[model samples]
Target: MGEQVSKQATIVGMLWTGGTPKAKEVEENMASYFNVLQGFLLYFYGSTVGAGPTLSSNLHQSVMQVVNSSFNLMKDSVSSYGSRSKDQKVAVPVLVGKVWEACSGLKKAPATNIAAIGRAMTQVAVSMKDVLREMRELKPDSGGQEDDQQTSGGVAGDGDGNEDDDDDVGDMGNDLSPEEMKVAELAMEVVSDLLLVIKELIRSITGLLKMEKADTSGSFVDSLEKLLKSSQVIGAQIDELGACLYPPQEVSTMEAALKKISSSLNGIESEVEDLKGSTDTFVKACSGLRGSIKQLELVLSCCSVGQLEEQLTNTSLSH
Candidate 1:
């Protein structure tokens, strides 16, 4: 599949270099491009026949992403093939570049349904970590020390000369007033707690992956797929929770995100239990995460109440 896509890439790339491909040439190559994708689909489906239950979830999503994105770019490349030289030069090559990317991506797609879902959950963990990193950088209203930050560059590089993730996380204490510091501190704790939740979620995914399922029935795979879907929902709500953490924190929105995350976690626990998978460690992780989430919700509720009281007090003074 990869080799076929590469050849098509070279062949289609030539169309724009010399001149506009003839209409017949465009039509023929368009068909060829499609054939390559079709061949891949056949291979993917054939290889994962045992994983049909997950076909509607991560496995299916991964295959379609490669196929559909490649298809769209290939179609655009063909359209550019029949256009003016200037148009062809500007658009076709970029489309061809993307097609090459899709080709390369084909080799990297997960070979197993478990791996596909694992990748999805790992991606969620990575995103949540990014949010935590960013939130940790949240400064006091008086602000962070810009001069210190300027000088702190290159200070944390490792032996590989690769800068650590903490390179971006500036000094935690500079000129923070009490109230602002409290907010920043609590906000950081909330993000940190969320990160732990995703960590536990990934661990649970790992446990499932390590299990040997004697039951390869459709229902068994379906249950696993449901777990993947729940992980995805938790991932999304984590994103929402992160986004709502900015100034004047949207307590309701954050609460809503937390609620969804808690619900999804419950769903995951239920699905795993149905699979008769070992759930003791996972259950404990979920319990700990739920505790953290409750604390965050309580903090948000306090902030909400404080904001309301301040507004009310100001209104009374004005009256």
Candidate 2:
């Protein structure tokens, strides 16, 4: 598993730094990386529970490093392809979707490793947010200087004769192409899905931390601290996503969903903070915590789908 992960990471790094590869090549590398990630996640889920603490910890760290590197490579690809063809530009969001698919498998990751997985997912979410911002800024090529000159000359000559017609044409030109809008929508959906995953993982770790058996040793306390730190990182990532470059009107639904997730995370943080070395109180709280998280995840999922549908409707209407 380690060898496979190393090889996959190397492929992603090469693709990221190496000059623009063919879209097919990028897709293949992303698929390969996803395969390796799935294998690692399955192994961790099936066997990590029985492994000793040292071994489990090592495995968790190794997997987290690989996930972080892979997502960084995806982000680099998005930035690196800024001047490339549309195909290459679109490939990044597709790769991001694949990464999200891989991350969804982490719901089955070992309880002990949930914190590490959450941290890695947070890194990926942050990078995706950056890519989404870049995508939103994309403007279709307006031909060249000649085209600009022609447009300006036409507008100048029109004066009051055809001013409204020129204004409508200009508006049409500035509107995002269908493909570009699709890419933006894809990026937003992937970011939203990742947030859901992070929320669930944190909630899972919190529940485990509050278990009676979990407090038998110092390890539980250590895990709780790690969860707290990871939660903070996720909270910051959520804030960044909420502050995306899109106009507030466009992202209002997403922002509202993020705000709800942020509140849930804060509540979890408070629960962790109020731990007074008592197992009974922790157990009582754990009973309802998972349910609350599930409710939030459902709400987030619905909001994301609605936002995407609304965007699609607007895009179609503009066309």
Candidate 3:
């Protein structure tokens, strides 16, 4: 399967990059390539999967959801064959990469129902952690110009040597006013608190997973699926929040993210009573998240009012 996926990814890259096995020929063979890959997935997801495999139903369904998304992306690429956009050329390779991930993911997918849900939520937490780390790199826009090599972290200079890379993220703390930097710091706090929510949420999931003879019944599996779906919802809203956390903070988007996060948290919390051995840690995390949101909103409102007053004062002086 890996070799097959490698061939597909390589071919797609070649097709878009004008490599061997001309695009027209590969275009004709695209369906066969897709079928070969789809067959592997079907072998796993089909009746053979139920031939006394340790993989739970939840694992099968979760894998299908992501694999289906990869299929849709590939279909779009095929449909736009002759007129691939520049972005599509770049993305087509990546979309193929996701198929590779979906297939490779089977080995990593948890066999136990509760643990499968835990694994899914953990992936979300890892993503949230990445956003939090990047948010740390964000410094208030000093209207500074960076060359191609220099990044938000700092310039690639102070090079001791390639063999012994110093590899320090540039701390430009002195570049911005404390007042300006505080907005980013507050945003970071929100991200930090959200991570706490994920941490607590994962604890609940793993707790349920650890129960002696964990549930495999349909109704229980349905509830777990709902939790995974809610986690995905929270994960998406976090992405939105991360995008808006930069300078000139997007208050409306941030507020909308908060609203959605609250709703998702409510859904997550609803399962607490039903999940055996789960604790109230998520409840406490939710409270902490609310506090962080309120703090960030305070700064946003202060900045908005300050801007309005400055404009009003400028108008009075002009009059």
Best by TM-score: 1
> Cα lDDT for residue 206, model 1?
59
Q: Give the better candidate number (2 or 3) by lDDT.
A: 3
Query: Candidate 3, which segments miss by more than 4 Å at Cα?
Result: 1-107, 141-180, 210-217, 301-319
Candidate 1 lDDT, tens digit per residue, 179-244? 434544665565565556556555655566534345465565567678778877876876786666
Q: Please, what is the TM-score per model?
A: 0.59, 0.28, 0.54
Query: Which stretches of model 1 miss by more than 4 angstroms?
Result: 4-41, 48-101, 143-184, 209-215, 276-284, 301-319
Question: lDDT for each of the candidates?
Answer: 0.66, 0.54, 0.65
Q: List the residue pairs that clash in candidate 2.
A: none
Poorest lDDT segment (10 consecutive residues) of candidate 2: 241-250
Worst 10 residues of 3 by lDDT: 47-56
Error of 2 at 277 (Å): 13
Candidate 3's clash total is 0
lDDT of candidate 2 over 1-319, digit per residue (tens): 6456655655665565556677788778778877887887797667665344433665676567557756765665756554656666556545544445445444544455434444554565566566556655655444466467767878888765354676657555444434334434554554555445445544555455345345455555454555545555555544554344233223444445455555655555454555443254444444444444455445445555356557778988999
lDDT of 1 at 97: 74
